[model samples]
Target: MEQILANGVYLGSQYAMIALGLTLIFALMNVLNFAHGQMYVIGGFVTYTFYGQWGVPFVLALFMSCVTLAILGALIERFLFAPVIKGSSREESTMLLAAGIAFFLDAVILLVFGEKQRGVPKIVDGVFNYDFRLIMPYDRILICVLAILSIVAFIGLMQYTKTGRALRALAQDRTAAQLMGVNVDRYSMIGFALGAMLAGLVGGLLVTITGVNLGMGGPTSIKAFMMVMIGGAGVISGAIWGGIILGFMEAIGLALLYQYGDITYLLIFVSLMIFLAIRPQGLMGKPWG
Candidate 1:
């Protein structure tokens, strides 16, 4: 039971990382960012290419991957999303553009990396035996610690910084923010870059835990979307809570379902669907102050 809880927390953190990024972009740009999964895989591959292949330090490699993706994300926004975000239409345009971007990135990475699985060398090797039934891995522990720290830092940024204030204002109301001289364009860029950086960071974290493959982006995107929808469509806090719910549900389902672990998502999604039908506003979506 303890091990399952631990796994839930670890997996939940990962889901939060992805869902957080997704929520940021959606809040500011009204775009779902289907390309995020590609960014995630790219982050892992970038870290691997540097640390696993080029002899760079693990920490440096992670930083490099994040920097690389951050730049990529910014450039993408500058070129593609900027127009759509400020234009008359939204839903279809953003989805089409983002999907195209996703496909392009996926193809490029597939051509470069081929069909191979790459793993990050265990930076912190070994396990803790909390007795026979409750052993835990250092990597998993590190992931949880890093996740908590990241969440705290993110909250601090949102709560205590000028930029954070601007972001919050925009998230609350873009037109009002623009009226208040909030430099919506600049903050938009900042939000996208931050979201992409988080995506990249989680990618590297995934590599550290279980390696990465070429075809991870699609499912990753789905998981992020699920978290966001379940928690609340546009609420930042909802993403975290949604991720925890999904992670815990997934863990519990896997434990109980055993060999039929794949059924976990089906069951959870059904439950979420029923819940959402009753409360379309999501857990933290509506009634915002």
Candidate 2:
């Protein structure tokens, strides 16, 4: 039971970290980026190529992956999102463009990497024993620590920095923020890039625990979307609350059914229904205007 609880916390932290990027983008852009998952997959592939294939140091590879994705996110904001928003029908065009990007990236990945699973070499190996009875991988502990640090850094930035104030202003009202000389366009690009970087970081971390493949992003993206929705669309705290809840729910459900056979999908569906019906605004969601 202790092992199961520990494992659940570990997995939940990863889920929360990944979901944070998605929530940030949603809050700022009000667009559901279906392609966020592809960015994650691409980040893993970058790490695999640089570190796994080219013998680059793991830390450097991780940095490179994050930087590359951040640039890609900026490009996407400029070319893909900006145009759609400037068009006659912003909402429809934005969704379609994002969906198109998702499909295109998925195809590109399938062509380049093929359909095989590949794991990123572990950053740290060996296990730590607690009370000389239970053993857990150091890697999992590292993931939890990273997750906590990331969350703290994010919250600090939002609370203390000028850029954070701009982000909040934009999130609340873009036109007003622009009127205040916040440079909404530039800030949007930066926000998008930051979002991508976060996703990539989560990707690198994931590679250490689970193997990566071309098809891995789709499901994870869907899960992140579900987490965002359950947390609330425009609330940062909602994302954290929703992600932790979903992660623990998933972990507990899996453990419970490990002996009873496969019921993962069913459990997920039930949880979703219960959350939606009981707390449609989510645990930390702000009241809608």
Model 2: number of backbone collisions: 0
Alpha-carbon error at 160 in model 1, in Å?
A: 1.1
The lDDT of model 2 is 0.83
* TM-score, cand. 1: 0.96
What's the lDDT for residue 24 in model 2?
A: 85
lDDT measured at residue 274 in model 1 versus the true structure, 0 to 100: 99
In the order shown, what is each candidate's alpha-carbon RMSD? 1.7, 1.8
Over 1-289, each residue of candidate 2 has an lDDT whose tens digit, in order, gives: 7776787778778887778888888788887888889989988888888888898998898888899889989999999897778774657777888889889989988998788998877778999998855568898788788877888898899889999899989888999999999998899998888888988888876777786899888888898888887888767777777778777777787878877777876878787889778877766676671
Candidate 1, residues 179-236, lDDT tens digits: the string is 9999988999988998898899889877988788988999999989989988897688
Candidate 2: C-alpha RMSD to true structure equals 1.8
Which candidate wins on TM-score?
1
Provide the lDDT at 13 for model 1.
82
